[model samples]
Target: MKSRSASKITLTSYDDLLGGVATLEDVREVAIDELHSFTDHPFKVKDDEEMKELVESVKAQGILTALLVRPLKKGGYEIISGHRRKHAAELAGLKQVPVIVREMDKDSAVQAMVDSNLQRENILPSEKAFAYRMKMEAVKHQGVSGANSAKKVGKENKDSARQVYRYIRLTYLMNTLLKAVDENIIKLQIGVELSYLSIIEQEMVEEVHDSTGKYPSLEQAKQLRKHREEKSLTKEVIRLLIIGEPKKKTSITFKQDDIKKYFPPDYDEQKMRSIICQLLEEWSNQNH
Candidate 1:
């Protein structure tokens, strides 16, 4: 094949596309104060040890990569990525940082924000929950089907489509229950089952976990959903599912066969009983 002649790139052509403003790929120094967090940004910018390291790096070398931002009608730029880096720059006492300006609508911005942050290694369940939910809605707004949206969101983060939908279910949970999922007190599957309950019902479940140190097993959570569907999941029903029915003047009864081996031969029955009570109280406090 014959070699094709190369065409020269013109700066004027780029300026025309941007309506006589700076080009899309232009890296400009924006004052740190002028950059704002993206609206309803799902990802967190934490000040943990990793953030401290980022701050130190910024202090020494400045920002190696430019942040992605778009101009807002309100005068400041909205950060689409590099929230942690921007925070680090603030902490590192930098007055300005480099940024690349792009024009994006809200839906596109949400998708971009989610895609960039999902690449992090140490994200919480709640973060993934909200981020996936946001990105899925954004995709659907752009006219994608629910299944395809889930697939696209999942592929971006190496999660299965089913897993993406599962994560989004967690968005239904109340704050306390969601925090429990983040803390691993409630497993993901159980959280999904519990998520079907109404907010008031979830508040009851949170109460059960708070007053008594009991969380739902997977089967128990499924049963809770069954009761929820029947519209009979009251606080009393929740309590019963969590800790089981109370005995008449419930006692910490121990079967002699099961209890004898745990205590020393020299210990009296009263002493063993007291020690067991003390241990149970400690466990309760820890869970509380």
Candidate 2:
């Protein structure tokens, strides 16, 4: 998908131009001296070979796309998106890459960066957690601010504001699992469930996780969680089984006719059958 540009918005100072236009010449390559990885927007460069190929391609084509950046009050610009592009530019021996400058408060900057990354087909679970957390915090700030106003934002925006509350809750996770999540070693929704486990519990969960290699469904994780809570299983014990499939609580279903046909004519027994009452009657009786 084509990235949307905020180039139309012009500003007088570099800070005000945080979300505005930036040209290649206007962007500087200050010796890679003071630049740091974006704290809020973290992602790993997946393929070194691919990145090298990208650098070669970029050198040949001259950075076909520009990176999105926000102004830092101290110095240089915060890269909101196109991290790979920046790395490729460095490898390509480019002095300065094209960029779109924009004014984004901390929260807005994080959300913009995350939103852009989420659009990608694949992103690390750790990356998702941080990005999701950033967006949620931004929405939360917006909600708190809107609450004080007489003309407050409507319910939809308010709901939108709360949409990521649970996702953001994942940020409280310990570094090990957080790294696992970021590495795409664990599923996002599963990571959310794992997040509910306390720090100690999460460590145990991680043990099972590491032993399992690949996580089972969330249902299995929930069962492991329950088993730990109820039976007080040792972490090692849970690790032994947690990676495997969960047990089926109910038997598989088969058509009654199919079962009956397989049996002899006189094999009917009351013990073999169970019944359910009609829901319509139950509803009518409840109303009456």
Candidate 3:
């Protein structure tokens, strides 16, 4: 009889491990502490409702799919994907997870990581920004011919090359402004225009917005970018740009008592305002 030796086994590539006849045997149960996150992972792991649901699922049925990882030179494995899953498993009090080990280069690891995470339905703007930027750099490092890495990434992301560049530009924005982008306080087009400004210029815009409770309109962002190009973007100029002449409000005002009958008793001022704005926007769209 011959004894099988684990030490003599070697994996040539991820495809061979995952696609070959060794698929079932390639997966192993590893201690959760043995896995490390990918360096500079762009996607966020939030404990929001989605994460809560994942944790519940993991607790109820266990992790259905194995995490994809690569063995590190020193020891343990670096996670190429399943960061959120790992986090959820932790919250579910899981000490071990199933993983598939793959031998891959840095570029391959990065491409795999980006491709896997980009399939998520609710990725934030900031996540997309950094992910696109990282994938673009990895594509270049992989010796991809030509300078159109954005086009390659765009094809995978279902966007145009120009749109990919625009999203990547968001990486240049300050943290506060970038947070605003994530919160939808600043639209994508406006965020792209603002990304052209220097860090200090972006800070100036953030300060003005914080102080005045206002955001830059598309026209205002364009003007700000133009001023920045001419090297005339100062605090005062930014202030005026963001706080451009406020249009006069109509003199007519509806008293709370008068409008209260039209709304539900549970409706608050913010909810009423939101409904009004939504109706107005729909009406404007229909008319136009």
Off by over 4 Å in 1: 1-25, 247-288
Predictions in order: lDDT: 0.84, 0.60, 0.84
Candidate 3 has a TM-score of: 0.77
Per-residue lDDT tens digits for candidate 1, residues 1-288, read 111111111233223223465433466778999999998888888889999999998888777666778899989999987899899999999888877688989888888788778778988999999999999998899999869989998987899999999999999999988999999999999999999999999999988888998999999999999999998889999999889988788556668879879988888889988998899999999999
Per-residue lDDT of candidate 3, residues 1-288 (tens digit):
111222333333345324444354667778899999999999999999999999999898777667789999989999997899899999999988877788988887888888878878989999999998888998999776444888898897798889888889999998999999999999999999999999988888888988999889999999999999999989999888787666888787888898788799999999988998899999999999
Model 2 segments beyond 4 Å from truth? 1-36, 144-187, 208-217, 227-288
TM per prediction: 0.77, 0.58, 0.77
Give me the overall lDDT of model 1: 0.84
lDDT of 2 by residue, 158-263 (tens): 3333334444556877888777666667666666766766788777777666655655467766766676668665676456556545666986676878767745
